[model samples]
Target chain A: MRVFRKQDEMTVKKLVTYLVLGFVGLFMLLPFLWMLSTSVKPASDVFTSFENPIKAFVPRETQWRNFPRVYDTTRAMGGGFARWYLNSVLVAVVVTLGQVTTSACAAYAFARLRFPGRDKLFLGYLATMMIPGAVTMIPNFILMRKITEWLTVVAPMVDWDASRVVSVFGRTYDAGRLVGLDSYFALAVPAMFSAYGTFMLRQYFLSIPRDLEEAATIDGCGLFRIFTTIILPLSKPALATLTIFTFMGNWQSFYWPLIVLTQDSMKTLPLGLLSFMGLYSTQWSLLMAGSMMMILPMIIVFLVGQKWFISGIQLGALKG
Target chain B: MAQTTRGRTALAGYLFLLPNLLGFLAFTLLPVLASLALSFYAWDLFTSPRFVGLHNFIALMRDRDFWYYAYNTVFLMLAIPVNILGSLLLAVVMNQKLRGIVVFRAMYFLPSIVAGVGTYLLWRWIYNPDYGLINTIIASWFPQWLSDGIRGLGVEWPPQWLTSVTWAKPALMFMSFWTVVGGYNMILYLAALQGVSPELYEAADIDGANAWQRFWAITWPMVSPTTFFVLTMSLIGGLQGGFEQAFVMTRGGPAGATTTISYYIYNHAFTWNHMGYAAAIAWVLFAVVFGVTLVNWRFGGRIVHY
Candidate 1:
């Protein structure tokens, strides 16, 4: 009788737990559902659906054109979304490539090779992570401005003012201004060498067996060749983890991009969306559509690389 | 182990490090030192810096807006416990050895990686008094009296959340909680929970300990290290939190209700062009973060079981 009573209590507890979890899960999922709902609702239906909350979740007629309208630069609602998308893609891709390359090279040194003051230098590098980013923002801004001024002085004295330099996307500077204000270089370059990436990669590299590298060295392979042939191939998971993180970070970066790229054409998606909010604060459907566009790539990436994302986070936790 | 070989290896190491070292020197280390120095000197971007020892810090103490923003920042950190505990509870639920748990975990973790600006904007829509999700849901679900009673207690009916001064900070805190309740914190806790040995629970069961006793004596102690880690990280992040949300949703307004130290610093540096003053604010923020971290390490470290 007592065992049956205990069994009944266990059933009750389990049911309550599941019920609570389901409710909280629904609450957590509501915003995404609402965002999707808002995206497809016609502009008039958006405000009207608010009268009935249930109707708000279900669009009267799905406006699929809202997605394309986001990219239509000619429309009042679509202000350079294509340009911003291109800029964001370019910056994220290039920055990820640069950061992974630099971090791997540096990690190889710190993890594998002997160096004077190596441990001390690494400690210093790690310590920099503790210094909050707010401390660096002002000084970096000043430095960027100084660089622009110095470039103006050193580069050919063009008759054109700095403001007239159309874009800073090209390798050749025949149009002048390689990295000043409104430049992709300014957007991507400062973010290319990550201390966290180097640290994580070093930890990963240290876990690799020394026997493989020693054998490669005996085979007349130089350090660069060994790194490229052996370590790079071996550390695919680590590289993928770092690449996904760096790309997502750069893609969604707001403040630095906002500071550097004042021109409309140079704005990344997040910055573009910020301006979109300012201009169309009341247009809920349009704003939702724009945001959906902004976040779609991130969601896709997360879905595709969900395993790496979870493991990467778990790895960082282990380091801590 | 050979000296000559060590010397050659060191050269090779330096060659590998040169690119990152140069970038780090130019970007991070030098700028960090420069920021400290710049806090002492007054400079607009167009003008030369003027040496003004401790003037910025002194001015900050006198600035009413700075104090208000600082208060707002500290107030928003009230959500830290909410976020930490909510994530812990969810992690407990998630740690159950059940079928299809990964899908639920993934759903919970989704909001965290969804773009920050997008999340903020979504919340902005949700907090809208007239047509927002929160208001609409409340109005539809709750009877008239409850809503009226809530308003009688002096909240705006359907709460002008981000727009109201009293409600804005709480609204922002709510958003922070929503973001983290199933995020990396939960994942960390889940990871920590998985590491707890089954033997501890089995031993407790053999000893006739109840579920609550088992949790407190075994599960709690086992997860304390993760708790400590989450606490430290959350506190540091909480201090720096309001800038992005406020920048997107509030712009530090409805009368600077959501203004935070980070936001204030950004404004002073960029919008106002008070670089020295901004650096001073940044330093103060750093000092607070550093002090809090130190305290957590000193006190909280004792309780954490590795």
Candidate 2:
């Protein structure tokens, strides 16, 4: 009787676990699988009935031309798709680098250094994260307009208040005003420092045991040396985790770049996608093609670096 | 390590923190305070802000679209528990002694890493009324189950998805599920699962506690802290309901069926450039989120085991 009960109980557990997991995995993966299928599928396969999952698996004709078209200028119009992609990459890279560096230095000080009102200051920093970005939109924009205007100081000299000069991209435009070269700095500079990263990293640092720091101090290590040699080495896992998330997020950023960048060459990926909608109309084929190109890089990164994402979140639990 | 001296190290810490401190104040703190003042005024993008007292707040109380977005946002919140449960289940399934679990997990998480716009575009195609993969398969064998007259035009022909009020909330909620269920929550649960003690399971096996009882008594409680965090984060994020999807998917369309509070605020601020009124909307959201979070914490304090 006991043996019978044991067998019955184990089977129920197994069944429950599988059903629960099956339902969830199916939901999470449906969208991505659908995308990959859409990218590679032909037109007939593009729209079947979504009510059923089976049609998604079948392909009618594989329209591969769409992928390359997403890269071409005729499709993109404002400029070459490659330039927009390149600009986005450059801006995201610069912004991510600046954010990590600035945040790390600040976090280190909050964690290891001594300063006045340290507790109060840290509290103040945490408080900042609660504020929504909408509050500062107009102010920041006005600030940027003023700054960008000042940057164009040379535009007047170039214009000579007389004539315009032609440049290599083959267009003769006013060299007149000091308008900046539609620079990436306008996007990257403002986003470089963040209160969020500081809060996350500072929390991670506090969880580290103090014994390691003491040992470094015993070795007559200077503050910077201790930071570089001890703290940084120990924080590798956390930093890597932050890098992936911040990189992915910034790479996908849209609104800020849209608001700040008026020049054609300055648009980021999300804005690039948004702009595509205006020219493409309702063409699903081309839109999917553009969407695929934009998403593929992030997919590749996440696939190769899945461990860090888990490690990053788990860090909270492990330390707690 | 010894908590150091009350001297130069502390001084250096302050110095190191200055950049971030200044940044937070300049960018975040000052704006929050300024927004409070904005909530009391009327201002446009071109003109200077004018103080008008609590008029914006009173206006918010009566605004129909504002209430509609709140109602829709509440509907989105209902999906949270479902999402959390679904993700936890996925984690448990993938966490098994199965082969190629890592790849499966990666595949599962793929949607989340992609840009939200990209995800929306892909889903839009899938949700198309005519040629969408979803309707196609369902239509072939089970005609009754499929929604009729799909244009095969994909989103050009999508079933008024995310745009029609009746279906907009559900569509947005479905997309939210598609976007995050497996990919977003799965990673966190998998982490929590790995931490569950094998010894406890072994002990439960020996103690005549059945698998069901073991899960209830041992596993469930162990994962409560993660559950609380996930719950809180989801509720908070759900309230905001990321603007990109609504902005792109519905544009608060079909008579504004899908606008969440965040999208409404975005419209007022960036679209209409109603800086003062937009600030007011933002404050209201902050209050709602803040208020809900406090309530969660108060209740959470009792049951969150970690």
The recovered share of true contacts, given per candidate in order, is 0.68, 0.67
**Cand. 1 Cα-lDDT:** 0.85
Q: For residues A171-212, could you state the per-residue lDDT of candidate 1 as single tens digits?
A: 322222366667667788889888999999999999899899
Q: Tens digit of lDDT per residue, candidate 1, span B70-170?
A: 88888988888889888988888878766668778878888888848888999999998888888898878878998888889977777789898878888
Which clashing pairs does model 1 show? none
Model 2 lDDT on a 0 to 1 scale: 0.71
Interface RMSD for model 2 amounts to 3.3
Compute each candidate's TM-score over C-alphas. 0.94, 0.85
lDDT of 2 by residue, B1-306 (tens): 445655668766766776766766765667677778778989884677788999999999999889988987797788888888878767766767754566567666776677477877777666665666555654565444233434342322324565455666777777777667766567778778888989998999899998589878887788888888888888877886657787776677768777778888888877787877888888888888888888998999799777
Measured by DockQ, the strongest candidate is 1
Instruction: Give the docking tier of candidate 1.
Output: medium
